[model samples]
Each structure stands twice: as C-alpha cells, then as structure tokens.
Target: MPPLPAIEQPAAVFVARPGTAGRLGQAVSWRQLMVWPRWVTLAGFAIVVGAVWAVVLGVIAGAVLGVFCIVVSTGTALIRRGLTARRIMRGSLTVATPGMGMASRFGSGALDIAQANGITRLFYDRVRGIHVDRDIVVLRYAQLFIGFPRELFPDWAIELIRAHRAASGTTGYSANIPALPPIPPIEQPDVSMVADPGTAVAMARESFRVTLRSVAILSAIFAVLCLFLGRLLSHDHGLAAGLGLAVITTVWLLASAVRGGPKTRAAYQLSMPPGEPLSARFGSEAFEVRTASARIRHPYAAMTSMRAHGPAMVVRSGGIHVYPRELFPENAITHAGMVNKLLAK
Candidate 1:
C-alpha cells in the first residue's frame, strides 16, 4: 500500500492580548447591527416615538418631537461607542492551534470564559462566513461572532485557518479568489493631520449613514416579505397586515432621515484634542492618509466614492476619509477638482 500524506496542523498558536486602543467592540457592534431583526427593532422604536408625539401634540409638534428623538438616539450611540471600547479593552483573548480554536474572557473571567477553563474552541466548521476589512477580521457563526485584530495573527496562520475552513466545506465571504498584492505606501503629503476624537466621530457618522441606508433597504424588503407571508395565510387578514407593515415602514424611513441628520451634526461637535487635519498625498496609482496614529494607503480602485461636500471632500472606501476645506484654504477648490477628476476616471 502507498504511504498516505500526513495531515497538516496549524503553523502557530499563542495567547493574544487585546490592544488597549483596539476598537474590537465597534467591530462587533457593526456586525450585530447588520442583522435584519436589529434594524426592525430600531425602526420600530422610531415609529412608536413618532406615533406618540403625533397623538399627544399636533402634527407640527410631532415632527419636532421626532427630531428630538433622533438627537437623543445619536447621543446615545456616541456614548455606546465609548462604553464598548472600554469593555473590549478590559477583556482578554487567546488563540491556539492543534486543539483549541479562539477563546476570549471578559471582566475578571480571566482565561476561562466559557467555563471550559475559559476557552472556547471555534471550529472552522462552525464559522458561517468570514469578512476582512482593513485591520479587523470577523468570523461569523450563526447569531454569534468573533472579531479580532488581524495584526494578532500572522499571514500564514490566517491561511491555515482558512484551509481548515475550506476543508470543512464552510463558505467564506471571499473564497477561491486570488489575493491582491499588498498596497504600497505612498509618499508623504504636503499637509497632515492627527486623527482625534472628532475625526473618529466624523468617520463614524459616515459609516452610520451608509449602514442606515442599507438597513432601510433591508427593512423595505422585510416589509414586502411580511406582506407576502400575511397573504399566504389569509386573504382578508393579509391585506390588513400588509397595510400595517407599509405604515410601519413609512414611519421608520421618516424617523431614520430625521435621526441621521442630527447625528451627523452631533458627530462633528464631538470633543477631541485639537491637532493637524488628515494629510493626503495622491499618487498616480493610489493615495495615502497620514495621522499620528496610523498611515493608510489605498489604490484608486479601492475608493468607492469621492465627492466634494461644500468645503470638505469626502472619500469613502472601507471607511470614511474626510479632507476638510479649512485644511487647504488656499487650494480647497483646486484640490477638490483634482480629486473629482480622479474619481471620474
């Protein structure tokens, strides 16, 4: 009989402590918010608030109250971000090979989170999907998730994990695709800015907008589904149910717009240390953003959109990149023109 090939094991395994500055909670929150049920809940709340105000006050007053609800919601969101960051920073994480998968401990739970000595084995077979965005890697499993900083795991280790996932027949967000070459760092820009709390808030607002739009679309689809299910059960009741869903969806959409406007303005007012604005150096093939914390480079193809908004230029790809007009007072228009030209191409 011919000798069988030996089964390959994971290349490396070690305990990985979460970074103090890591936004693990934010990453997790993003994934959680992506669920349709969560969107429905949020929209439902908005609709209820709008309904109460409409009844108690007049139509105009109800409109005002709706606006107030949105402001409060935005403030709550900002506070949640801070709390999430703190909680994640206080947690401990360990990743291993051969046997154990990835485990995390929150609070004083130390190394034993799940009571299996605080270790949880996330077998590749359990992974429903995988999503990679910049510095974070998200492993989606049913309703639960495990998000970790990519820097904690070596490239080879990631590949090994993927190999196991493939062998287990679990599908990935991106599978069987050739990996793109590493983005080369571009030259330093003439102007630079340190990303502060305000900057983070601005980026968050943009992200929130994008997410809200997606949720809105999904909510609309869900309304249709509800209508379909209602009709499938009973013709008379189904008509009433469909109408109810339509009303709920309409209210949700209105509230979302009202809430989003105030949120964006609130984000701009977020407190942060005064520092230089983000600097950008545009290359023939790519652009780079430099700040005190990180330097990021992205090819033009990676940019999803670039548009001049009043005095500021907003560039969104994996995240929001803002170039405020104040940073380039002398050449704001010229710079925006150049960027618009590139985006058009």
Candidate 2:
C-alpha cells in the first residue's frame, strides 16, 4: 500500500477555452456578478460619489445619484458579459509551469499562461479564490483567474491545485510579462464564426425587448422623480430643474433605444456561426460546453432564470445565454434537475 504523489511528476498539458471558463467561474451566480473585494470597492466609490453630490442636492437626492451610478455600472457590466467572454475566449491559450515548481510548490505553485494579449506567471498564493465548477477548476487571483479542465488535470493534480489555492493571498497584478521560468508557448488557430441567422434574429428580438423594458422603467421612474422635485423646490427653481431633468431623461431613453438598434443585432449575428457538434457533459456541479471553436463550462447553479423565446432558450446566469432550443439535445444531457428546471421555467 502507498500514498499518492502531489500530482503527476511534471506538467499536464491541456488545450482549453480558459478565458470564458475563467470569466464564468468568477461569478457564483448572476446576482453575485461581483466578488466581495469588488463589492467593497464599489461601496467605497458610492460613498465618495454620494458625499460629493450630497453637498449639491441635499442628502437624499445626492445619495440617489450615487446609487444611480452604481446601478448604471452594474447594468453595463451585465450587458457586456457575453461580449467580453466572446472576445477574450478567442485565439489560442498558452500555459506552462516548471515541473519541479509544480510538484514542490503543490501547496503554493505557479502558472505561466498566455492569451491573445500576452503572457503572465500567476502565483497560487496570490489567488483570491478557487472555484471547482464541475469538471473545471478556476483559480481567481484578483483580476486574474485561469480555469483548468478536469479532463486534463488528474485527481492528484487537482488536489495539488486545491492545496496551493488554499494558501492564496493577493499582491496586485500577477506577473504579466512571463520573463520568469516556465514561459508559455504561443499558437493561434485562425477561426471565424457568424451565428445562425435564425438564432441571431431571435436573440436580437429578445435582447431588444429587454433593453426597451429596462429603459421604459427607468424613464417612468425619472419622470416621477422629476415631478416630485418640481413640487419640492420653489417656483422658478422647480420649473428650471424639471425642464433640465426631463431633457436628461429623454436623452437617456434615446441613447438606450439606439443601443438595441441594428448594431446590437449585428453583434449577435456575428459571434456565432454553424457551430460544430456541441458537447454538454452534465454533472452534479455544472455542465461543459464544447464546440469546434471553444470548449467551456457553466455551473448549473448559476442559472438565475430560464425562459423560452421562440425557438431559442434564453438563460440568464452570469449573463444572458441565448441558445437555439434544438441545440440542447443535439449533443448530450445527463442531469435531470437541470432538465426539470429548464422545463419548469
């Protein structure tokens, strides 16, 4: 009888779509799009912004403005989720770690990785958190996190990572230039995708509806607030403020209308093409999304809401994933709960 080694002596190489998985794993759920550290930063920003506005528009009004900024920022982040993931997930992934360092420092190892932008050596101790999302492991260190597919990393490898991750700390940006040991190799697969026209149109319509509804709600709230302010202030001041607020609100509405315009549709139509066979390996924790261009995973628990949109399946998780309904069964599905949930929703 013998005990297992930390991990296979040297390195275990893998071809991965780490960018999307890393981004996806950073979020536990759509509601928790921001990590605690980020939320703290946001809070600090709100306080500072609120304090500045408080002087101009009294306490309550000033506080409202600060909150509005926070909302806008969060909304922007949400809206950009799909775009960010798609952009970064493109191109090839480069990764390498010293065999000795990986084994010896299993409790505090490091990874040198490169993407479309550049290369970086991420120290395990600097990682903010480690999330084991089903078949993938994501080590999030501040603004950096790389997801390793479980298929590539064996049991001991994962344990090593877990051990190293458990001892993580922060030191700002992890080595960005990879002049260090275990420099990553670079290779790119020239590939392009244009989503299915039908799916694109459906997603576009759904996206437009969402934007329009959000803008409408915001417009209504703005009108009511402006009217209230008109009565709250003196005659001339109230009239002036009302006109200004009305103008501002109107401009915002117009801008939002344009956002859901043809440009948005074009983006949707651009991101996906006749995707090859998609593989969704369902398990207790999450599910894997495999295609010719990319292979990523999503935590089933992250699905905030699921609904039907024509022939599409609109899933609101870390972001809105609009899938053609027929695509679900094209590959594989193993989880009953997810199936049940999707069906129920």
Question: What is the lDDT of every predicted structure here?
Answer: 0.48, 0.48
Model 1: per-residue Cα lDDT at residue 225: 58
lDDT of 1 by residue, 182-293 (tens): 1222244556556455555555455455556776786677567556644654565554544565666666666766665654444343312245345656555455554332
TM-scores of all predicted structures? 0.38, 0.40
Q: Which clashing pairs does model 2 show?
A: 125-169, 194-272, 194-273, 195-272
Expressed as tens digits, the lDDT of each residue in 1-345 for candidate 2 is 011122223345444442534444333233235456666765675576557546545677556756765785577667665455443332112121212112111223465432212233455545556666565555665344455454444566455546555545322233231222332211221222234546567766777777677778777776776656554643545445545555666665777487547755654554333543333344455544333223334555545565666676666654466655554543233353455465344
Clashes of 2: 4
Model 1 off-target regions past 4 Å? 1-188, 192-203, 246-272, 310-314, 319-342
**Judged by lDDT against the true structure, how good is candidate 2?**
0.48
Poorly placed runs, candidate 2 (over 4 Å): 1-195, 234-244, 247-250, 260-263, 274-285, 290-293, 329-345
Q: How many Å off is the CA of 176 in candidate 2?
A: 22
